[model samples]
Structures are given as C-alpha cells and as structure tokens.
Target chain A: MTAIQISVFLENKSGRLAEVTHALAKGGINIRALSLAETIDYGVLRLIVDKPKEAKTALAEAGFTVTETEVIAVAMPDRPGGLAGIVDLVTRHGLNIEYLYAFVGQRGENAVVIFRVDNAEEAITALQEGGAHVLSAAELSAI
Target chain B: MHETTPCWNREMEFMEEGHLRPLQSERLRDVVARVYERVPYYKEKLDAAGVSPEDIRGIEDIVRLPFTSKDDLRDTYPFGLFAVPMEQVVRVHASSGTTGRPTVVGYTRRDVQMWAEVMARTFAAGGTHIGDVVQNSYGYGLFTGGLGAHYGAELIGASVVPTSGGQTKRQVQILQDFGSTVLCCTPSYALVIGETGREMGVDFAGLPLRVGFFGAEPWSQSMRQEIEASLHVDALDIYGLSEMIGPGVSFECLEKGGLHINEDHFFPEVINPKTGDPVPDGELGELVFTSLTKEALPVLRYRSRDLTRIVTEPCGCGRSLRRMERVTGRTDEMLIVRGVNVFPSQVEEVLMRIEETTPNYLLVLDRKPRGMDEMEVQVEVSERTFSDEMSKLETLSERIGGEIEETLGLRVSVRLVEPRSLERSTGKAKRVMDRRDLGR
Candidate 1:
C-alpha cells in the first residue's frame, strides 16, 4: 500500500523505449525507476515513475495499455541488514514475494525497496507493525 | 445468362439438380421411415421432439428435421450414421481429428460407387477424357481424398496411376511414363510436384497434365493461379465434405472461377453462424448440407463450418447446379489474436503471391508476459528461389508482415525459414500451430 507499480506494453523494436520516454518526458513526468521483461516480440515496461497517474495517462494516450498495481516500499539502512530486515519480517508473516526490485531514495541514507508480494496490504501492515519505515510516493519518486 | 444443362445427368459426375430433387425426396422419406424403425438414436430424437417420419415429405421439409453435428457422429462412435448393418458395410473412411479422436464413417459398396461417381464427375468436369491417364497424388486410405479422386478417374475410363501421395520421384515418373493428363491432390502437394518436376528437368509444357483438381483444405485463389502457372494446367476447384459425401459434391469445369456444388446430391444452405437462421443469397455464412440421396449414411443439415458465399447464378461452364466461391476459412479455425481475427488462409494468400515462398508455413500463437497474444509465422522459403543474403531475408519478412497485417487486420511477426524447415505431413499439410489457451 505504500507503493504502486505500473506496466506498459511496448513493441521490441528500435527506439520503442525512447518513444515511451519522450512521451512521458514531454508530459513532465520523470522515470524514478524502470525494469523491462521481454519476450521474442514485445516487452512489458514496469515503471516506478515520479507521477504514476500522469505517466500512465500519457502512455495510454500514446496507444499503450497500462495497468496499475499496489506494491510495498520499505525504507531500510543502505547497509547489508537493511534489505534483510524487511525480507525477514515478510518471511515471518508467512507471505511469499512474487517479485522485488529496489531504488535509492532522493535525500536519505535509507534506500527504498519495491516489493510486489502476495498480500501487499497485509505485508505493508505487518512491516509497519514490525518497526519498518515506509516512504510515501512523493518521498520515493524524487529518487 | 444462358442456362447450362443441369450437367448433372449428362455428366455422371453430377446428378442434375432437377433429377436429384425427386430422388432426394424419396430418400428423405425412406431414411426417416427406416431410421424411425431401426436406429434408436434417430427414433428417440424424432419422438422426443414430437416429430414422425411422416412429417418429412421432401427435401424442402428437411429444415424441420433436427440438425446433426459431428458430436452426433462421435456420440454414436463407429457406425451410428450407417443405414446398413455391419455385414453390409464394406469400407470405412474417417475424419482426421489428430488433436482429439477421429470420427469414423462406414461405407458400403454403394457408398463407394457414390464416391466414384462424384469423383468421376470431378475429373470429367476438368475435361478428363477416357484415354487420359491421371497421376492421382491424393493420399489413400482413411483420408478419402486419394481413393475418392482415384475411383472418379477410374469411373471415367481414365487410366489412373495410383500414385497415392509422396515419393516425388515416383510421382514424376508416373506423370511422364503414363502421360498422366490430370493431377488431383491438395494444392500444396501439387506445388511440390511442380517443384520436383523442374528439379528433375521434366518438361512442364510437354507433360500430359491439362487439368488439376485441388481441394481437401482451403486454399487461396492466388495460390491456385501459382499452381496453374507452375504446372501449366487449367486448375479447377473441387468441393466436398467427408461427412456429407467424400470428394465429389461439386467441381469446377473449364471455367476455373468458382466451384459448382453437386446441389442434387448435397443440398446446401448458408445459415447465419450465430443464430442458425437462413441467410439470403450471395451472403457469407456457414455452409450447411443435407445429404439428400446418400444411402449407407444420411446426414441432414450437417454444418460444414466452411465460410463461403453461395452463388446460385449459373456458371458459364454449362452447370446449373449452384456454385460456391473458394472456401476462405473454417469458422472453427478462426483465431482471435490481439483482438484481431486471423485465418491461416489469409497468410497463405500472401505467401503464394511472393513466388519465392513455399506453401508450407506454421502460425505460432503464444501469450506474452503482459497476457496479450503474440503471433509468429514460420514460412518455408522455396529452395529453388532461395536467397543467400540476410538483407533479402529481412526484406521478405518485412514484406510478408506488411501484407499479413493488411490482409488479416492484425500485426504478426514473420520469420522466413529455410526450405523444409517447417513440419510437413505425408497427408495434408499443417499450416497452423495455435497455442493460445487450448487448456480452456
């Protein structure tokens, strides 16, 4: 609940990513972080951008199918135990992590790790109850 | 337009539409009565629906009868459609349902004769004279296409070279030695023969083949023209359904435009596929057939699922029996990939036009990570016109993709593979490999 993920379908051709980036850039939305999962013909561009709403709307207007999903952003120490502490908390709560990718926060020693877990809402609640600091969308987007 | 003689009576290939009506009427009446008395399946359906054999007066009254589906044949399994006993049944041919279980139909000697007559008429329509030898390449056995064409050639007094599919060298030898005048097989096989003949330096112009009757699967008109040009024969289209009658329902004459349905033997009705309502003339719809005169097995209004527009107007070939345009695709085979409807025949048409591509191709539909369908077309590049350059291959793929998108109204990734790269069966080429949600 502390973070959200958006998926963008892009054809696997030259300059397709550039086209998506230019559309979002012109709409004043910067990419905070992105990862691509590809097949033989096309790829799904998962983005944690500055403004998820504006970026998704811009991409949709550019003829891309975009879907938003809820995820968790756990702020942890940049040291080794920082990420381990959050994973340990989720494992303790009996929740499986479907996918996880992290990005550094804008102005803190703490790094924000994006976690797509089986139960995003329960995982967020349990992590907070376990003394973890979660970053807001605006606080994490400046990363 | 000058009316062609029903050609059904004069040409043994056809039973004239007019001549067939009374025979169909009598057969309908007899089958209903016989089925009511003998077959429990028929009796139960008729009785449950509060219908009686007396209600079926003629062929026109056929619409009132219940529709029989492939399920009906499968539900009964082996010999449910047979009007005769096991001892009376002579031979059997079946639907090649490779994905599931095949449906088998038993044929008595009379059924074979019916097949022979229809096939014979098929050859005669192509102007096959008695002395001509035919290089019959259609597969034999349960496929029905091979023996169906062979018997028809034999019935017309043409010496048949029983070259039952494959063995390219042997097929060519028979073509040259016996002077096979007419070729009968699927359009793809015919192209293979043409390619092999050229490789062996067989004279295309000097070959005895003047006519070729191609059917079994749906082929494009562009491919038909390619086959005609390659083999130097007046190519004709032969239409038949195994369920209704094996390979001689209707045929094309010297007029190579459309196929003339043997309306007398197989009365066709184009119906709205969704609602099952009758469609007006010249409209595209699912083709349904009522076997008016079949004895061993009579199927009433069995849906062929072949998408074609019916043309009742007489052809210039002197056949008044209605003709249908070449089948575009089957309703069952229509694939919805990425919200666009795609048919294998559409891609086939584009490939045939390229002249450098073989008829062999496979359509692979897979789900992308985003849960959307992606299509990949694997086409067999002709070895004769093979290109060595990567750029040429790229250009070929691009051109094919563009044409496919234009024709199918869907974007597809086209891959130009080497000759024989795609899988080929000895009988009936598999042109599509749809892998999108078959589990459901």
Candidate 2:
C-alpha cells in the first residue's frame, strides 16, 4: 500500500513557502503533512497533501518544479512507544527508512505517519506482516 | 632598470610600414591568384563579383575580393574549400555548427608552419619564456584551441603541460606541484579552476602562476578582473576562430590594452555590418579577416561576425600589428527587444560588477499580448544574496532591473532563480532563450 507525496522545488527566497501554501489553498487542496529539506540557496518542499494530483498541477501552474512520489503511510497509536513498535518491525526486517514525518488532523483515531523507504514494497510487506495497517492512496486522500 | 619584452619574430613584427605593406600586397596577390585558380567556391564567388587576381594588386585593394561566410563554409562541406590536394594537406580542424554538419578548415605543411610562428609570437607577446611551464587546459582533439596552444608553447621553447579541460581539482594540483607559470583555457574554466583551488586550499597567489591566455568564448573585461583576482594570475583575452587558424589569430600583449593581429599572415578590417562598407579606424563595426598566406585553404575576406573597433596606434610592446579591442559582442547574438539592441554580454558586465549576484544567468525573451517582446533575466541567488523577506529579494531584483535598464535603455524584468539551476556548459554557454516563437 503506497501513498503519493507531492514535492515542490522552492528557491530559498522570502515568501516562497507562503506562495506554495497559498497556491494549494487557492486550489482548495489541503496539505496533510510537509517536510522541507533546505539548503543554503534553495529547498525541496515535500508535501503530503489530501489531493496529490491536483496539488502537483496547481503548484506546477504556479511555476514550480513539482514531482509526485510514492510514500508508505501507516496508521499507528498516537503514543511515543506506539511508533517504536512499527519502527522495530522495519528495522528488524533490514528495511531502510529514507525519511519519515508525522502529522495531525487526519481521519480515524490512530495517527498517520508518512514513510519514504529505500524499498517501499519490502517495507510495506514487513509492516503488514507485523500487523501494521498500511493505508492506500485512496484511503489516505479520503482522510 | 627592468627588462623589456622581446618579439618572437622581430623581422616581421617590427617591420616598418614601408616594407610591410609591399610584403603584404605581394602575399595577398599570390593568395588571391591561388584561390581564384584552385578553389571552385572562391573562384565562383570572385567571378560573380567581377573580381580577378589582377584586381587585388595591393593590400589596399583587398575589398575587391568576395567575402566568405560560415554559410559558404557549410555549402562546401568537409574538404570542399581546400585549394591543395588532400594528400598535401597536413591537418584539419572543425567547429560544430548549429546545423547538422560542422565547418571544417584544413592546413598545409607550410600553413602549419605559419600557424606555429604566429602562435609563438602570441606567447612572446605574453612574455612566455623557455623557463616558464605552460599548462594548456583548452580541450584537445577535434577542437583547435588545445593543439593550437600546444604547438605554440612548444615553438616558444616553454615546457608544456597538456591538461586539456575538466578535472579542475587535478588542474589546481598541477599548478601547485608542477610550478606552472602560464595557464591556458577559456575564461569560464579559469573561474572553475579558481573556485576549485579555493576548495582544495591551494594558494594561487603563492604559486608561480603568472600569465593566462583565455579564449574560445566571448567574455567580459570584468570577468578578467574576477579571474585575475581569484587565480592571482594576469589573464589576457585571446581572440580566434577555427576558420581563422584557431587561438593564435590575435593576442593581447603584456601591455594588455588590446589584441594585436598577425597582419602579415592574416589581414583584418572593420566593416559596418549593415551596409558592408569599411568603417573608419577606431570605430566599432563587424570584424572581417582575409588570410594573406594560408595555402591549403585561403579565406578571402572571411566575414567574422565579431564586433569590435580597430586601432592603428603604435603598441608599447613594439609590434607594428594593428590592435583590436576585445570583442564586445557578436552581431548575430545581438537581441532586438522592442526595437532596441540588447547584448547578453552587457548584462554579464553588469552582473559581474554587482557584489550580491553570481555570473551564472539566463536571458529569456517572450512576446507579451500587445506584441511587445519582453526580456526577463533569471539570476541565480546565492546564500549571501538571499534574504528572509520577499520584499528584500524583490528590491534586489528591482535594483538589477534598474541597472540593466540604465545601461541598455530598455526596461527588463528580473526573476530570482535557485542556485545551480542555470546550465554550466563545458563549451560555449548559450545564455539566451527566445520563447517568442511560441508567443507568435
């Protein structure tokens, strides 16, 4: 089960991040979660928006370098050790997590976390075998 | 008292106008006759223009010869322009054309000898000696810059380091370890070398590197200052094209005022690009060259699209060869924005003078709804130039726009782009993007 994440290239100038958020807001698209990898001159803004396809199109129309990536979104308990239970399964299976970020305000009682692993299929299988509920693109977007 | 620079070929370089004119005339007459009889391309061009060998009796009558252009070179593909048999031709060089086939130039044995002498004179003018180590960084192979500079440095008795472009880190180490005295490469590569040296902690000012012969692309004077300051070497602008026998066609002497043409071998003229009439001396116009002594391929009044002014004033270096200002810009590269001429170099000169901006930039042209062609300069913002507020960045953009409009007298839009987004080309960098075709 893979969820799509929208990535936008943002120049490290003032009000650029705001412009991206403003464009998504204008398109009536909601951002679920975002992680900004910043450099000295520019930054890659990774967004897990509610509507990935429309977000990509809107941000691109706004003159941005946008790319859609598949990330594993797994549901887990909101407690601190509740996340370690899912992390231990992937670590025990030798799965490498490239990057991960947690966000609030999604559907269901459990919290949602986005995971970009080096090998997504193996990570999903290991997590599923460990009884972690993996969310699909539809289930995540519907939230 | 300090020692003065010496001429490589004293007899020819220091020849008085009284003796040099007739020599030039005699050679011009012979070459004109040779091309007329041998090369079918020149033959047809000359005959159509109602010109004959007798019409060109002296250097003053050079205008009688027909002008050959890149299109002419393309028409006569690979070996079409060779006046001599292929067996007699010693070497050939080619430059990639924007179209499919490349423009090829061939040189006979004697022609190769002439190239060596002129290139040697170029090095001599730069004060290169047998003791100095010359590191040649221009790319080797089909390109003429590498081999042209290689043969010239060898002819001048200097030890050669043939490190043809790329591996900039290795180049810096060679500069430090080999104790090279002279550096050769394009101005852009020189910047890369300086930056790479800083990264590697190589102190260029402490090294023995002295003079640099930079060419193969059009560069601004401010770039010279940047390279000189960074590499701690005196950078001299070398001018040439493959069609004109590569990088030795002309070179700036240590005097550094302008490049002196090897007039005895190659004749030069400044012409008004629009009317094709010879512009008076010291006036800006398109430059044209007519090879006086090339045997295998004798170019008769080859129209070099480079724009510059010629000065006949005496050079302090004691060479009688006429001087040309560093090429300002190419006539074809000139962009007409809403009826005004905009040069990419003018923008480069402006960017180089500014402290907050990097030289890597692109000029994009598009047509607005009212049919007005708009030009937007995409400038890469570095960390130091970047600000936390959007208004500050817009202010920087406005300042850039204001400065460019002040120089070109045309309003332009400035866009801030991410660093390293602009393409850094190994060869000639294409800076302008014309999207007007899509606009139309």
Candidate 3:
C-alpha cells in the first residue's frame, strides 16, 4: 500500500511555492495533497501529484531540486478523530510516524491520510491487520 | 616630525617633485630601451607602432607606445615576456588563470630586491615597525601575496607568524596569544576571521591588532569600516597583481587619502579605456603602468585595466609619491546587463551594508529565452536571519533586490541561499559565473 511522493528543495523565499505550483499546473499535473516542512534557510515541499514521474521531470526542468520518496496512504472514515484512530493503530503496532498529512477523497466519501514511516512495508502490513484500509499507489493517485 | 615618520626609504618616498620626474624619466628611458632590445614581443610591437627607444626621450612620450594587455601575457605564455635570459632570472610567480592559461612573471635578483624594497615600504607606510609581530595570512606559493609580505616583514625585522590562510579558530588563538600587531590578507578573509572570532567568544577588538594590509581583491569602503570597527585596527588597502611584482605596487599610508604608488619603480598613468589616451588627473579611467626598474619582466606601458583616478597631491604623510584612488572596478570583470554596467564589488557593497546577509555571494548572469539578459545574485543569509517564516525571508530578498537596483541601476533577481552554500576561496574569491551561452 505504498505510494510515490515528490519532494522538492526550495529556498525559504517569496514566490517559491507559487513557482512550484505554477510549474506543475503548466505541466498539467494535479497536486492531490501537499505538505511543507521548513527551517530557517530552506523548506522541503512534499507533493502527492497525479503523475509523479511527469511532475518530477517538470519541476527538475524548471530548475527545482526534486526527489522521489515512497509513502503509505491510509484510508479512514470522514469523521471526527479519524486520523487519531490511524495513529493509535500504528502506535499500538510499535510503528512510528515520521510525518503525516491528510486529504479528503475526490468523491468526498473517505479521508485519505499520507504517512511517512521508517518501514513502509511493516507499517502497511500492521495497519492492514489492525483493520485500517490501506490504499494502493493506483488507488491513491485516482483519489 | 619627519624623523618620527616610519618611511622605509625616505629618499624615494619623500623625493621632491622636480627630482621625482627626472628620476622617473631616466628609469623609463632605460626600461624602454632594455625591453626593446631584449624581448622580441616588445621589439615587434614597438617596431610595428613605428616607434623606437630614441623616440621616447622622456616619460611624456610613453603614451606613444603600444599598450600591453593580459591577453598578450597569456599568448606569450611562460617566460616569453621576460627581458632577461632564463639563467639570469631568480624567481617566478603566476596568475591563478581561473579563466584560461596562467600568465607567468619572472624576477631577476635585482627584481627580487626591488620587490622586497617596495613591500617593505608598503609595510612601513601602514605604520608597521621593527619588533612588531606580523601574521601573514595571504595564500603562499604561485600566488604572490604570502611570500611577498613574508619577505617584506622579514626585511623590516618583524617577527613573522607565517600562518598562510585557513584554520580560522587557530588563527584567532594565535592572534591573541602571539600579540600580532600587523595582519596581511585579503579583506574578505579578514571578515571571515572577525566573524569566526565573534562566534568563538573571542573579543577581536580586544586583541593587539594595530594595522592590516588587505588586498588581492576589490573591496568597498563599507567593508573597510566594518573590518576596522570589528577588529579595532586601521584597515589599509594594498594593490598589486601577479603580472606585476606582487602586493607592493601601491599602499595606503596613515593619511588614508589614496594608495601611494612606488612611482620610482612603477610608473602610473590613467587612460581612457576606449580611446587609449591619458585622462586628466582626478577623473576616472583605466590605470596603466610601466615597470621602470624591473629587470626580468620589464613591461612597457602595461594596461592594468583597473578603473581609478590619479591623485598628484602630496599626501599628508609627507610622501611625494603620486597616489591612485582605490580601484573602483575592472573593465574585464564589469558585467553589462541590459546596457547598464554592474560590478560585483558594487553588489558586494550593498550586501555588506545589509546586516541580515553575509558578504559571501555569487553573481550568475544568463540570457533568458526571450534574448534578454537575466542577472541573479545568490547571497547567503546569516545564520541568525535564516528563518522558516516565508514572509521574513521574502522581505529580506526584496530588500536586497531593491538595494541592488538602487545602487547598480539594474533589476536583478536575488536568491537567498543557505549559509556556506557558496564556495569560499583562500586566494581570490570567484564572484561571477556567466551562463548566457548555456541557453543555447
């Protein structure tokens, strides 16, 4: 249940976020979900786009430093404490969440949360056995 | 009052203007004859210009000679420009040749002695005296700065530290423990030391640094002010090139008005860069020099390409040697962006004034897809100013861009890089990267 995520290295300056988004839009790639981790000097922009390879190429060609990382997307009910339930399941299985962000399904039926963990395979299996719905790469991209 | 002045050679430094002109005229005549007779390159150029040693009767006629450029030196390669035979040459030094083939310079035994004499004069002009401790931090070997200063300090009987750049922490400790009174290095390296000392909790101002001889790169007045205040020392500018005889061509005395050229050894002339005609004193132009007494490498009417004015007014320090204003920029290094001239040093002046940015920066020039020139200035934000807040970072970039536009009269995109992202140099720092052809 692992998915591909595109991360870009960006200097903490004005119009940088817009530059990346504009490039993706011009490339006709849709960013389904995104999160940004930043420090004083630079930021890490993580993106879940429709076409990961194409988005990476477009951003790289536009002079952005980009990287590909594998993450797992967990599906949950679109209700209160939905993310908390997934976190509890991972914690009970002794799996740590490196980082996570959530987005509503395109159909608005369920909430899909993307997570980065130390061991993607173990997290996927544990979450699956814990009654969590883990979406495949195709399913995550479709949503 | 004259007895108290620390002039290495009072005769040359305080020569009367009337005597100075005759001395320069005699040396100029002798050097021109030597080059025309010994070096084929000078001979052919002089012959092609339809001029001979007989035609140059005085220093005034030096304008009639052909100008020698760095490209000429490069074309001749190693030892081609040497007037003396290889067996008579005693020393050799070369330019870094970051762009292409290195230009080599040779020195005879007398040339070495002359170099030592000028460097000693430079040291004394900066108020360094015997029994003082000197820390020579300019890079050693091939590069002329380190060994040039080393010999000069030794000639003056000062105790030399011989710490040849790098090792910032250790350099600070040595500065304090050794009681170094004289510092010699590029000004940027001096700033690096000051910043590193402050980070290490060392009070650089509390140290015994009385004077600094900084050169080998173009710097600004604001940088000098910052360095002087931070190190609590009188920061002086020294000018020279490897093509010339190292770091003793000229130096700032206590008057700090302008750098006094050792005109008795190196003749100075300011010429319009395009027209090749001498510009009147007090006006900006390209600086050209002719080695009056150099034995091995007697360059006749060598174009220095440095932009500055000649100051004939006698210095308050009692030196009659004509001084040249601080070099503003170089013709080769000036970038024409959208028909506006921009010098990296001007950008550096702006960056040094901003408290949030470090002096370390890179200028990238490229051609946009639409055939317009695009200039990007990559500056490293100080560790304290590096913030995750996009608004603060954007404000800093905007402020830098605005300052550059105001100063250089050209709009440039400012890219704020991480601290230490740009490469630091022990020798001359590479500041510009032209990628206009990469678009092709």
Going through the candidates in order, what is chain B's TM-score?
0.77, 0.83, 0.80
Candidate 1 lDDT (Cα, whole model)? 0.77
Better of 1 and 3 by DockQ: 3
Q: How many residue pairs clash per model?
A: 3, 0, 1
| Each model's DockQ score | 0.01, 0.05, 0.06
**Candidate 2 C-alpha lDDT tens digits along B1-440:** 11356668888777788998999999999998998899888889988999989888799998777788998988999989999999999899988665778999999988888888888998888889898999999999889999999999999899999999999889999999999999999999999999999989888889999999999887777778889999888899898878879888988988889999989988999997777889999876789998888888889888999988898788887777889999867878888888886778778868877777787799999997788899999887664545433345567778999999998999998887866678874456778999997623
- Sort candidate 3 into its docking category: incorrect
Over A17-104, each residue of candidate 2 has an lDDT whose tens digit, in order, gives: 9999999999999988889876555566889888888998898788676667788998898877878898898889888776788775
| Residue B45 alpha-carbon offset, candidate 1, angstroms | 2.7
Clashing pairs in 3: A40-B387
lDDT per model vs. reference: 0.77, 0.85, 0.87
Q: Is candidate 2 or candidate 3 better by TM-score?
A: 2
Per-residue error (Å), model 1, residue B258: 1.5
TM-score (chain B) of candidate 3: 0.80
Better of 1 and 2 by DockQ: 2
**What DockQ does candidate 1 have relative to the true complex?**
0.01
Candidate 1 structure quality by residue, lDDT tens digits, B62-171: 77777778888888878876777889878788988875667887777887887887777677777787788788888898888888888888888888887788999888
Writing each residue's lDDT as its tens digit, candidate 3 over B114-142 gives: 89899999999888888899999999999
Where is model 3 chain B poorest over a 10-residue stretch in terms of lDDT? B383-392
Whole-model lDDT, model 3: 0.87
